[model samples]
Target: MAEQNVPIQRMTIIRTLLLFLAWFNQFLSMNGYSPLPFSDQELEVGVSMLVTFVVSIWTWWKNNDITKKARSRTEYLKGKGIM
Candidate 1:
């Protein structure tokens, strides 16, 4: 239970940070100072979509890292007959 909660707690912190970043990005876009500079397309669909895609990929990577770590620990303990 302790080990399980540990990863979950860390993941929660990271998720909150990502949510804050997403909201910050949205606020910038509404105010006309989005990260990607291009006065022509204020409603830059491609740029916004790109950021969203990147965030998705990042989240997927984080989840994968967590899974790999958990698996490695589990396997290590099992190999030593500690599990």
Candidate 2:
């Protein structure tokens, strides 16, 4: 059976928002303005933690999606006696 060429969506709005936040924080610090309550170092650490957490979650979600797709494909092949 021919494989179904479905494209998975890899881009997430949450990640983009996180990236924008980090960039905006840096931009604010560079302009000598502390828009947030935390110090620069503290903000960096906090943002770093957020990034790590988001990345972990995203990785798990993507892996889950891929696994589901693989299982579906496998079952399809088995149904067609192609496995």
Candidate 3:
């Protein structure tokens, strides 16, 4: 299938911002600043689940692209502008 020219940098920035917000929220809670109504334990659990889910999905998506299309590690790195 032909891939769309998705902006990887834009996606990365957005994902980073989202993950930062999750961690920042947790940080605030840990320091006794509760932004949400949930208790600390509840908040911790919720954030843990959210971070795990996002990371899992991100890992799967990136790995799928690399494994399905890249001929080698070097090719994958080059494609990602990391080489």
Candidate 4:
């Protein structure tokens, strides 16, 4: 389907921002950003990286021209420039 050129909603902006923050938190917590030790740090880092990967894949699947889509505050690396 042809995509619309109209701007998206502001609520979408707010919601996307929240989602990005939540993902970043996971990325931090999983990396043992605080009290977690080095051994557990690996686990956290692995989980965060995996989550990041999944988000990027999902975003690409949702939008064929990923770069052409509107800027969203999502945490996926693929959506970086747009955001």
Candidate 5:
């Protein structure tokens, strides 16, 4: 059970970092600055962040759906006096 939580924790950290990066990039752009003094680097980081955000949302949705189904099944079984 604890082992199953590791991935979720890691993903949470990754998502936080990615969001920070996205915000940092926007701040730099608004201030006429760049992290690496390169135009393309910021664009790459933005694209990567967009991809990560989409993937994270998809993963969360799937996980939530699965958990909901599992919980409902457990409740149904309990109602039937099976466990």
Candidate 6:
């Protein structure tokens, strides 16, 4: 069975959204606007999640190309009875 790879472009989009959300939240805070009445701790958690999401996305993007290449190599090897 072949392992599936995450699409880097989709992850990039998700990362962008996470970053935008974090920035928008901060912007609202600076303007003294509270949309949902979230606590400081909850805001902190939101930032943490954004950071984690971006980091994971970066990691996946970094590895996706390598994973595709490896899969192609594996297919070639199997075709040549080298696996």
Q: Model 1 has how many clashing residue pairs?
A: 0
Tell me the lDDT of candidate 5.
0.83
Candidate 4: which stretches are off by over 4 Å? 1-4, 35-83
TM-score of each: 0.37, 0.46, 0.42, 0.35, 0.37, 0.39
In TM-score terms, which candidate is top?
A: 2
lDDT of 3 at 12: 90
* Model 6 stretches with alpha carbons more than 4 Å out: 1-31, 66-83
Each model's number of backbone clashes? 0, 0, 0, 1, 0, 0
Candidate 6 or 2, higher TM-score: 2
Instruction: Looking at model 4, report the run of 10 residues with the lowest lDDT sum.
Output: 65-74
- Output the better candidate (1/6) by lDDT: 6
Per-candidate alpha-carbon RMSD to the true structure: 8.7, 8.3, 9.8, 14.0, 8.6, 10.6
Model 1 earns a TM-score of 0.37
Model 2, position 64, has a per-residue lDDT of 65
lDDT of 1 by residue, 1-83 (tens): 45554355788999999999999989988997756565646557777989999999999876663677788987898999998
Error of 2 at 9 (Å): 16
Which pairs clash in the backbone of model 3? none
State the lDDT at 27 in candidate 4.
Answer: 90
lDDT string for model 2 (1-83, tens) is: 99998765557767888899999989998999887888779989999999999999999876663676788987898999997
Name the lDDT value of residue 24 in candidate 6. 95
Report, for every candidate in turn, its global Cα lDDT versus the true structure.
0.81, 0.86, 0.84, 0.76, 0.83, 0.87
Best model number under lDDT? 6
Better of 3 and 6 by lDDT: 6
Off by over 4 Å in 5: 1-8, 36-83
Clashing pairs in 4: 30-44
Return the candidate ranking by lDDT, descending: 6, 2, 3, 5, 1, 4
